[model samples]
Target chain A: MATHGKKQDNRSPADWWLFVLGFVLFAAVGFWATPAILYAEKPQPFQFSHKLHMEQVGEGCQSCHAFREDGSYTGIPSLEKCKECHGEEPMGETPEEKVFSKDYVAKNKPIPWQVYSKQPPCVFFSHAAHVANAGLECASCHGDHGDTEKLRTYEYNRLTGYSRDIWGWSLIPLDGPPKRMKMDDCAKCHRDNGVRDACFVCHK
Target chain B: MSSSASEMRFGMVIDVDKCTGCGACSVACMSENNVGVLPDETDKIRSITWLRVYQIDNGQPYPNTQIAFFPRPCQHCAGSQGHHTPCVSVCPATATDRDPKTGIVSQIPTRCIGCRYCVAACPYHARYFNWYDVPWPEGMDKPLSPFVAPRMRGVVEKCTFCFHRYQRAQNKAFTSGEAMGEMDYQTACTEACPSGAITFGDLNNPEHKVHELKKSPYAFRLLERLHTDTAVYYVSAREWVRRQADNYLSGEKLAKVQAGGGH
Candidate 1:
């Protein structure tokens, strides 16, 4: 009985590393597979640089993502907006601009840009309230996308069809807007700011 | 439960005598709110309507009979003490709430779990449960207003007093850096009333018409004794019409009371 107990103790201590190995392996697999399995990526219509456009436009982000006279944000710039700056000729010598000129600009077709921050149909986000009324910076909610040279790959949930930005890029639910934009994040901000967090305020 | 001084109490006061029971208000309410139309809407048990007009008649002999129409919408109850609105309190999912800022009862169908508790708790029968997913006919979905989200089956919906219009008006006000005028926000039914029987505005604002109209001696709310503290009011000179608004004991009678007096 004494020999058996001693043997069991020795085996248990040695096998503790195996349990640690299994846990690490499983956690790593989970961290890798979760995003890959749940999300599907779609490319934007063509490459366009906000950095390049930002240099030429007088009004920062409003020059392209303009608000209508009624205060509604015109989310994506229409083809007519692009026509204001670029005519039949390609603005830049890049192949992307060549494709934009031939396929979209010259054809007068609207670019089917994949929106990264497009919310669910149920959410009624008023840019006028956030931007005009509260005077919130665009970068406050939407990271530094305007400063990026190239558009990032748009990833959306396979089940809900919502952009990954809505749930956020982090697998660990530890961050708020600019990293994640879930309902709780919004409520938290509203609560902190002494804003009315009524359901109808955000939801239609 | 009284609102703070700065809070706006959006309400409506309808002159029942001027209402011809034409149902234009009901029609306008449905289109404005995107209330579904069923193939067999004649089946009142299953049909949904945001604004329902009840036909009431004076119980008089052949030569004296007179009828009046009561266009009923969600009362936007402030409850007995102010915050205990029957439907809002009974909602287990917190799908419905009375907005303290606007005093408008807001129902979020997406958050509703189809419990039907709110539908049963409402004394005014203002809430309706959607039984089926509304199948918009070919080309019918195109004209749907982008402001209001279409509710799916298994949720309760009711009148919002055209809150989306208020949201739009607020957006315009935000842009113009000006306060929202009385005419800036009006419900579709109020605008559609041919006889101008329905007057909608912030009842607390003295500058608006409804603030004064609701104070008339003829004004009364439905089930006032129950103390729902509803935002909607009705005015009728006829004794029978005011009597029909609430239940009374055999010898009991409705006393002449100033509207907005409960607040």
Candidate 2:
């Protein structure tokens, strides 16, 4: 055993330290530098809590988010939709509601809400296929964001400019909520469900 | 996979005799699909035309002069029983496919790798390769149809039979709780034809107008001998016009081809 161990130590002590240093540098870059370079933090237009809205309205998401007759998904609620409720005054005494009513609804201006799950222009996503045809819930891909009381900062890739949700949130990929919205995720889900799709099924 | 009894086979039947060669079909297709206009359209071969009208003549002089216009769409070829269409089978990326349910050859621009294999493989030259970036004029982007996404450079695009309209029609039918039929969905070219020459419908459906129109004695498909099994059929009463549909050998008489009753 001693002879075998000595034979294995064919390199100098300095060589061992250099190898250790290289590994440490690689791990630091991968664990730290990669995430910093890959993601960009941006603030949302306003603090909108879905949980609070759900509690107040006592309705599902489709009430605020409508699917058009043409099968197009009205992703973000239009300002006109907000005007329906906050026509005269703010829904709540909160600062966000006050700002929304005064700056947007009352002034007849549109609120530029930053969309977190926006896909690239090339990708053609059909909300009807997932929600109407497949009978999938909004939470399947979006996680419990609808139940979260506070608005989280939108994280996007610096290079591809895609949402962090597209690449999955965790760098280590521990397999949690907010599953990546990449094509691989779609393919895997389709495979699991045995839903055969042509290339034009989701693409145009 | 087992085919459903309600499977639709969408096809077009164009009456060449009624066509005035106005190029309305081509114009409508381009505008509807948001097909980019090239900076230099002088090079006809390089230019993109989802639905092109080719003028063919009998090569007669003066009084005997005869000319006919052929508006060629993608054809959505359903080659023989087992094989896929020529373009679809040759596509390395599987970007183009014939949807068995609808018999519509669908081209996915996003999945296209721009290899141009399918473009070359196409006999009708239906597929067009995007050589350069689409130069959208000032304020043109805003007017683009939301249903059809503008194709990026380095991809191939062909006639999609206005699939978005089908999706919309399907959605409308679903909402109304009504069954969608051939009349529910029609291509832009078919709708824009001033002469009402083009008849589009589910060829498989016995009740559809196209089913009756396709069986007309005057109907003939382009290059039928190649056995492309094109969905689009042309109808012309003129014997010379029928002869122009496909090639004939020196010994093969026109009477013999007519007896065969369109391949």
Candidate 3:
């Protein structure tokens, strides 16, 4: 019985290290969790009226970002893609139509169109990889932009090419199932979702 | 393509004794890979070549002068059981990979955003960057091999060991429902060399001629001590030509290796 007590007391140093690691993980969750929870889940930039665009005009996401033959996707509609359809002033009624024809089409520049969900460069955020592989909704990462009624005005960090809000905070829960689009955020999702990768597999 | 580790150290062995300095292999590699040509390709570094023949000469004047041409390409290291390969270790993007199946180092050009770290990591300088976009004179894009896409400007390119051929061969096997056979793949340079200097086959297969040639007494890898585990081996009777491929420090361990090991 005395020997059994001694054996019970003699836990391996590995056990101690694992305990320390668990405590560290808990602390990290606590520290990071607070900021993410508190941030305002502000409405998206530009009042992008998706119902007006998708429902009334009968356009799809592909109407903007053209699909490639090889299953890759390309840029949102360039000024030319818009000009191809919208004429030099005909059947225009709403303020939105005026903004599209007069401001964007009249000027030869592609709409300094702010891409709402611009994932950073170091990561390969293949919409194909996720959509085809995991069966995830677009709203899973990009918040409910499709439901909104106005153009989402883009907020920028500029230097990092990250959204100003994403650089700091989001109402998205960091502790729950992966909600954000950081590399580690995606890595966590991959781990939970049974997708695996090396650092180079996604980093570059 | 994969087999047990003992039977799967994929490699290449080059016979320098049989080689002539004709640039046939280089020309074939460029055309086969669809490597873009700049109007100013006179500069070699900025130029793309999957197989490049380098001229090496015994630095003696007149009658004593001896010249041999050596071709440089990716070594495709076996990588120390599971450790560092010069290019494979440092790649920030998983653009390059040593296939465990065949031991071929595969390059994914689309994944490579011209980070040139792999270019600099290779001791042989095999990888090339597309500085200028591929400009096919009007109405010539259809002639391109449907298997290989011509690379755009700003991507790193290299010898795929003619992986498109391997893929086609694999596809044929898949449709026929037969296993991929030994003679299934041969790099364009190997077939194009007039002198038959380059031999391409899976080193892992004992029945393959490449496997037997690998055991020759004359066979040696480039920079073996740097531990790159280079697949390419050169067999040269000329000591100067063999020595020119890699640098040896003054009275270094390789001097001892040559004295004691009899390689």
Global lDDT scores for all candidate models = 0.87, 0.82, 0.65
State which candidate, 1 or 2, has the greater TM-score.
1
In the range A74-131, model 1's lDDT, one tens digit per residue, is 9888899988989889877999999998998778888898888888877888888889
User: Of the native A-B interface contacts, what share survives in model 3?
Assistant: 0.00
> Across residues B68-147, which tens digit of lDDT does each residue of candidate 2 receive?
98999999899975666999999888888888788899988888899999988888999999988999989989878877
Question: What order do candidates take by DockQ, descending?
Answer: 1, 2, 3
Model 3: runs farther than 4 Å from truth? A1-204, B1-10, B250-255, B258-263
* Model 1 RMSD vs true structure: 3.5
* True-structure lDDT of candidate 3: 0.65
Q: Candidate 2: which docking quality band?
A: acceptable
| Candidate 2 lDDT, A1-204, residue by residue in tens | 355756656787999899999999999888887887778888887798899877766458887887887656789999888777677487678898887778887789988876777877656677766777667899987889789988888888888877787764654444433656767777778888987666666666
Candidate with more favorable, higher lDDT: 2 or 3: 2
What are the clash counts of all predictions, listed in order? 2, 0, 12
lDDT of 2 at A126: 71
- Using TM-score as the measure, which candidate wins? 1
Query: Who is ahead in lDDT, 1 or 2?
Result: 1
Winner by lDDT:
1
| Steric clash pairs (candidate 2) | none
Q: Name the candidate, 1 or 2, with the larger DockQ value.
A: 1
TM-score of each: 0.92, 0.90, 0.55
